[model samples]
Target: MNESRVVGQVRIVGAGLLGASIGLRLRAAGVDVIVDDSSPSNLNLAIDYGAGRAARDTDDPALIVVAVPPDVTAAVVATELTAYPDALVTDVASVKVAPLAELRAAGADTLRYIGSHPLAGRERGGAISARADLFIGRPWVVTPHDDIPTAQISIIEDLVLDLGAVPVIMSAEQHDSSVALVSHVPQVVSTLLAKQLLRSTEAAISLAGQGLRDTTRIASSDPELWVQILGANSADVVPILRDFRDDLDGLLTALAAPAVPGARRAVAEVLADGNAGVARIPGKHGQDRRFSQIVVMVDDRAGELARLLTEIGGIGVNMEDLRLEHSPGAQVGLAEISVLPEVEDRLIADLEAGGWKIAGAWR
Candidate 1:
């Protein structure tokens, strides 16, 4: 393990969506990166998308990130370690415990190995979805074992930080358990809810609104990939699913007898609990709370967005994320801007005073 914080070279294996994105980020930050993928199509796509140059067998990379699926992550890491004996190795697989145990059982080199998971992704997959800034402001967990060298740990930390992510250090077991609650369990819940909607009548789904769409967004994720992630982390996931079932059973019982005081209280308490739980989730850029969403009606001309942005700048309230929804046959577009919750009213007042139409405002 080397203890130097400076990262020199990076090699990413797989050239899938995450791999390509990582390579692009490293290269954009002026770091040398080489990418390898077994699939020629994926490699070509990644290179065409400006990920990195195709990795050569002779190039001894300082850090290697394996972005393959969870099922194959262990074997791939083992082969990379053997191929590049001096390179520090890590993986972006969702589950860490199974692969770490596999590496031990297979007697692979553990000194250079660090387990990592970037808490970010889109519903879209493949190199086509690759973006250099995809990981910006996201949490990247680094799970290191006792046998790993300090140098290797530092290398992983620097690489993750350089990629514009916040590096969180934890043990492999702890990382897996934590994600099971936040990432894995929520994915399962979304899928289960989506499945219920799938079996419903067409009229039922047609009546669904934005709330349903928001809750079921993860259902659009790749089912095959999730199968591997959920299966690999089953040990941590099963207990969560069991507890979920117990809560769900209680909710269903409340629905069965709505007039019962105890059941009604339980249902109300669950909803209140959900409100509290949502308040605890870290907001954008890991802030404790999110700003209010303010909608502004924008004209659909070429310079309309620029004009709105300039107007916003004049108002002096810090703007957050922006979303645009174009209207059919209408001259205006719905521009949703996020601002500090307290500043929302001030922003609306300023924009409205400056001749900009205020569409709506919500927290």
Candidate 2:
């Protein structure tokens, strides 16, 4: 199917972050969207935010997207499949295997259903936080059953592309296992790390740095929602947790016996392994490209950062990534700009010639 052609109407079952985001993007693309939610306020908010309109009884959508909580995903999907018999159905729940299993056990129309998960979200939730570009440059995994028609799978893939997401096809088991390692385990670790701060002194928290903030940022996610997600995928998560526990035990043993023959080597190996693992993560949009970074010092005064950015634009060098860091009490901030390795030396020279203070550059 052509991507630019009209997709007709898309009915969304939930008005939360992912549903509203899909609505917003599809509406922006001139597709008719009807949004329904159990919460009246959320549906109204999504409508007011230009996501979509209220559903009508006579409306027959070509596609139905179920974005409700993981716990109720199976019920909602089953109901929608029965209600919209002609429309192809897909759900954006994080856990894939459990819901599909539930639908199979219930003897639902599994042939008309596909499972999908968009790897994009904010620390917050609800329609108010929805954006049309939420799924841009992100991977959207499509898990199609063996009995599903190829044409139906293509429709879902086209919908994913229309929402500005790259579609990656995988089986339900593979999808569940992958997210268990990458997404679920990280959330569990972050929440556990943040829990330690509950018993810390106020003075100690006041001394916390960006490292602490970065590590615990996702800990602010809704606990109830995570409880459901973690529970649904517990079978996959438990094995990963066991492996993690073993690594933690090894680290503790090394720390306790610092004087032992191989204790120092064990600690060093752990840190080195972490560095390698981080490097293995693909860059934006699963691109394997690596970038060189240049750090420029800018004053804290107004327009300084803007002036730096303007100067970089004038240099005709494209920046791949950017990070800003400010000292605790310093009047200066550091802006780290990432660019192609071949352009790093020339960019630094041009910036220096343009009177910008260069802090450092690294590959």
Candidate RMSDs in Å, in order, are: 3.4, 1.9
* Tens-digit per-residue lDDT, 106-168, candidate 1: 999888898999999999988899988888899999998866767678788888877888999
lDDT of 2 by residue, 156-223 (tens): 99889998899999999999999999899999999999999999998898787667877998999989
Question: TM-score of every model?
Answer: 0.90, 0.95
Q: State candidate 2's TM-score.
A: 0.95
Worst 10 residues of 1 by lDDT: 1-10
Q: Check candidate 2 and list the clashing pairs.
A: none
TM-score of 1: 0.90
Model 1, CA-based lDDT: 0.87
